[model samples]
Target: MTRKTKPSTAAAVQMPLKEAEAGKETNCDEDKPSDHPKERDNNVKDNDGTKPAAEWKLPRKKALLQFRCKLEDAIRGDYLLGRSYWSLSRLSRENMSSASSQPLPLMDIRLWGVPLLPSKGHEGTDYVLTKFLKARNYKVGEAFEMLQETLWWRRQHRVDETTGEAPLGPDELVLRTMYVRSVDREGRPLCYHVYGALEDREVYKRALGTKERVEEFKSWAVQFMERVARRLSFKDGGVDSVVQITDLKNMRSRSAKEARGVLRSTFLMVQDHYPELVHRHIILNVPLWYYTFHLLLLRLLHQSDKSKFILARPAKVTKTLLKFIDPEDLPVEYGGLLRENDEEFSNLDKVSEVFVGGNTTKSIRIPIAEAGSTVVWDLTVVGWDVSYKEEFMPEDEGSYRVTLNRSKKLRESVRNSYYINEPGELVITVRNPTFKKKRVLYRTKFKPTVPMYVFFKS
Candidate 1:
């Protein structure tokens, strides 16, 4: 008998010869002559040897297709047109071209004359651009135009330099009523506005009479925003958003009416230039009439903007304030742990004299006997409005420069303390531009130290 041929170990694990020859079956387990022992060991380790095949998770075909389609739609629709009512020509073509090739390019963002890009450190350009796009319904051209117009407005008004210059004489009222006092839990600057504190409405109205006054108001508003931005730009744990508290505790009908114009103008300016700056707004002690005004304001704001506003009555003011601010950082008057005797809150109302009436001017001159001394003043006004100007006229022929030029209205108070570098006369002037008579009260004292210590007893 002929010697029986034995099948090789590899042939037993492979497909039958007839099936392999016909190419109708593949033997995945069959070892090739070119395969190395190391490769085989890796395969065996991956499959655990006893198992015939390795486990694999295949993606769902339908789900993958759906995801791809949605992604394409997002890029072609939202990113390109921003749900705009009007269609753009080049953007449409670019969108069509991007569908077959690469991703769409974002529009160029510029401030003043410099181009800006979004990066890990700074997202300001992207932030401002997205706001404009949303405001214009994602029409790239219109959004760009809107952004350009705002930039031009800022440049024409020279908003960046407003902080260094003397505030318009009328803005003193705003300074007294609206101011940034402290920081919140997130380190964002906390701005406080006490609408109820306004004692006279007619004074504010008279102060806001001319176009120049209105422009000045806007400039000061922008300057405040710039100051906030500078704070945010600091490297030491700065925040980009601001927390605003508007207290309407004693707001009257006449005061509300007078404030409407100023409020409207400020709202529009904020919406246009400083987008995404206010992270939260707490409106405290809101009266029933305020809801009507709120509704009107809602018409001017985007839907996204509405969510940032929080309304609270006097009873719930503390609870609402505690949400975004720490008790330690909040002022004592606002139900926080900080004391009224703290440096930030102390002597805010330490006024000495009070005047009432209009169309009058007053001047006071104090001759400084010694150089390098300090002059401290506590001044306030009641009834109408007044303009304040101070100058240091040297004994010699040195030119006198205006140190303070601010206007005040209603019952706001101002405290000014400055040091004299040279021998000069401190000339103070207060003028009432309105026809109505207003009361003025002021007190001053000379100090022998570099930093004045008028309030402290030795």
Candidate 2:
């Protein structure tokens, strides 16, 4: 659901490149003062010979031309032109008239050597293109090159098709830590990722041992981003950005190291490939060591990237979260109203249990008592990582399909509700992959049918 705007036919204003290249030197008499009487008298006479105040004004047409020229000159003089200035200048001038007249062909819209076309159902390619252009300081060639590289990388890894594929057992552990739960007040999707919840180093390394597996993981990451992006709609009142919340509670030294290993690549992918997609990044429960590590990371980011990050400690987490998200949409763990026992969830029934084990897997089969029913679960893990999943085995001959897959390490909880499409066996599995025994708590509920909305006229 990419945002779309009606294309404007107005010509893009062109900046004067020549004047920008050659800096303007203003002659001011205030800078040069002579002590001699003769020089002072001569300066006064010259000033007297200057045009009168009323005569200094030009005709309306001439004045407009002059204003346009000055505007161009100001833009040109403000920023230094880099190596790609010439390419940008030529492209801007050549396309100025045509861009004003009609829509440009998607294939012809080249950013460097890569062709940039609007995604299906998204007609705001030009709008997104402008963002990349601004990010690179309007250097078309440089922006295009960066965009091209990202597109090429995406193609090499088959990022577009990642949503349909299944993650390996081990990879599922990492994927579960990052979750896209719901949307914010402005319709921007809210994504939560717990950095401290990554698996052990050896286990993670083993999971990503091969290059193909590494690419697969990267593809999964991109797919997660695409899921967030797909929720955006730019139809007039629609939002075109996402809000990310990074929870750093219970982070240890080992977790820091693991987080650092993956964060750089993740940041690079987001900044380079998906510029301007993130509206706000709220970091909750930041650790002391995080400041030192964050400072180092800041050196690699653009200044604009630095501004989007909002860091808050435990004391201010609630206030900070409330500023950007409504209380209803915010999770109860972060001092919001969405949780078990809350009014919204009060009507739902619950089945609660606590399991303790190591290197053991637990399975729960929830029989679909009736079609059109709903299955909901809330799971939490303590002290270790757990691989969790949900599958549907059809009563007929169809193959089983995985509805949910994830792995989490932190003490955080996961809640999900699914509407049963067909009468089938709903299987829930949780596996403790670590050597140390860990505690896992879960609550599940099944409804005969999902509730429908009801309204009454006033």
Candidate 3:
């Protein structure tokens, strides 16, 4: 008879799954409508006594686009992409709700259980995922604890370079192993087993050098794991506690296929064995996407010893960098400081341009049928937005000049703030503030559908 262990401290027992699926608004895979001013602000009372939620609703096209954009931003900001351990693509309303709600403690009965889905044949009533195991009077807690202990053992596996034998922990601990075979002098392959143990000083590589040594290692490994399992009240049901096989021979023959099979099996197995724990830890697996840009900057800064650049006043450096890149040919394109007669700028001519606003030009125009709805335009430029989300630039007089088209100037001058929906032609001129003879012009034809946000870093 198995001696049952008490409930696991790591598993929660009481939070029902129903509360995890609420507060979710399902989308039909269609674009969400854009909001009017009041709607965008959650229909709050406007300071100017504008329209209320009952009086304002967003346009279908605008809402859809905005939602799509926000979703995209969320994905990008979170770095939910390739090789991420967290499967953001697997996110659902239930998962999102479960994360937001107050979670129960480990002692709660709901911790080891999962709320059954309506379609899961528990129609009209909620069921715990582990209820079936409970009905069989099996000590699920013991099984769970044993699994955790096994993983902990695996995680702690290490060996000393000099020890030829496995070392034991202070207490009895479980271990796993595999068996493999080798070829004999007659060219006949003889089978042997190998052991993967925690703190096993005898590394398998040296032990498996000969067929006889290999068999000896495998025999010891199987016996060791079996001993641990028996001590933990675990029985070797039918399958072998460990497998024996030649590693290099098998791996080389089917690398790709084996890898795919292992990946698929591991994911499903993890979900089956520890669904709740897996869900909570999934976010940790996600790649830190936003850090990529920051990392790149830091790397470049280190490589160039540009530490002083990052320390400069944000406002000064920000504007300078902005004006530098705001041109058709980036300031960097001029290749740092230029000779008085560089061939690159030989064909370039300076032109007279007016600067009314800051570095950003308000040349785009987007018309809205309603006065309250928010308007935005899409500019495909990568990492060009003025939002602080991007790297900081310097603020300088000679760095960059922004000009607005005549129409946009008229609008912003009258309204103080201009909103555009479509792109309009605008010219940006960069000149040598002192020499004033060497200059470059950048023409932007892209417009933004979203409200453009500009900030001074300093």
Candidate 4:
């Protein structure tokens, strides 16, 4: 067995999936995106927000042209007002509540940031409309109806005016349970839904307290989605969808009632309004009992959404998350080097890995020779159940060694900070006692700190 010293990537996990490397969105199977000269040219200004030409097959293209004409008629006839419409493609509209009690205009319509007037020649027009078309499987009538209903819903609810940071903001419970973290490997925003946070007695009480409170939570949830969506570019080939990570480890069985009653409606409403906006729905740390809950929930979803769902057992949480996100971009809690609001490391810092053979130990040495400097490091071992050691070894053998951790049997990612007064190296060791090889990923950073003596200078 060779000695494991320093950060070596000889044993890094070989990522086999290349889906994240794909450049174009997986459009409907009708036609492949054309490699048009204008689409390829970076200098083309008019098509900045438009999709590639010749993306639709002949029939779908015909249907799309007809759909555009229908949109023009809808704008002129003012049919996109005074009605509450749900996505009847899967679930019924009766389960949803009534439309808003406000008047609205049908003309000058827009979805997210793209104008809906097909005659306007805005490049984003076709791009935005194509999403609705795809959601309806290229059925012109259904897609147009969905578009009209979306516009009606937006105006009747006064979503533009009321869906600001206030008047319907998420409370402490919502903030704890759900949040927007970093981006995935494909640069899609990651929206984390940690239902485990609901186990907090206070959070539980607030989330399931009363019928009215639950309704408020639903409204707040919808607006939160809108806020995130509006920030996304409706432009062609831009990040238009978000990746949702739902963690179910700490959620209680009792809360399944809330999932059925409250979460079900909120989820359906989101699906209705936000068509094709979720690039992926990754559910992590799924417990055994949650399978029953998932089965029941599946009955209420559309086939499109059902296809997007990816479930991971608790044991595969870290591995599954890593498949779609690079280690540097993922969070520390999810077995990656990234730390939310981390001071020592950012997207700029790179993470490397080391491989340990079966029944062997690996030592990672990070040299920091500068005195009066603070070094921070984070690391984790895949399928970690091994003993680890951390110490500071002075460059000069005459100096004594400082032990950070004598030995630790780690199961999750870890981070620490240390200050150096002399030239030394931070050495971390992980022993793989098991019969299989192990992979270790780590990153480090250091910033000079003002020594006490320097501050005392007169």
Predicted model with the maximum TM-score: 4
Q: Candidate 2: misplaced stretches above 4 Å? A: 1-122, 167-175, 199-217, 340-458
Total colliding residue pairs, candidate 1:
12
lDDT of each: 0.53, 0.54, 0.25, 0.68
lDDT of 2 by residue, 87-188 (tens): 544554564464343322322332222223322112233334544544564455566566556655654454543444555235466565677654565556
Model 4 TM-score is 0.79
TM-score of 1: 0.46
Instruction: Give the C-alpha miss distance for residue 322 in model 1, angstroms.
Output: 1.3
- TM-score (C-alpha) between model 2 and the true structure: 0.48
Model 1, position 342: C-alpha lDDT score: 46
**Which has the higher lDDT value, candidate number 3 or candidate number 4?**
4
RMSD of each: 23.0, 21.2, 27.1, 14.6
Candidate 1 lowest-lDDT run of ten: 32-41
Best-to-worst ranking by TM-score = 4, 2, 1, 3
Answer with 2 or 3, whichever has the higher TM-score: 2
lDDT of 4 by residue, 110-129 (tens): 67756666655454556667
- Give the residue spans of candidate 3 off by over 4 A: 1-143, 146-153, 156-255, 272-275, 280-458
Q: Judged by TM-score relative to the true structure, which candidate is superior, 1 or 3?
A: 1
Error of 1 at 334 (Å): 1.8
What lDDT would candidate 4 get against the real structure? 0.68
* lDDT for residue 138 in candidate 4, whole number 0-100: 78
Using TM-score as the measure, name the better of candidate 1 and candidate 2. 2
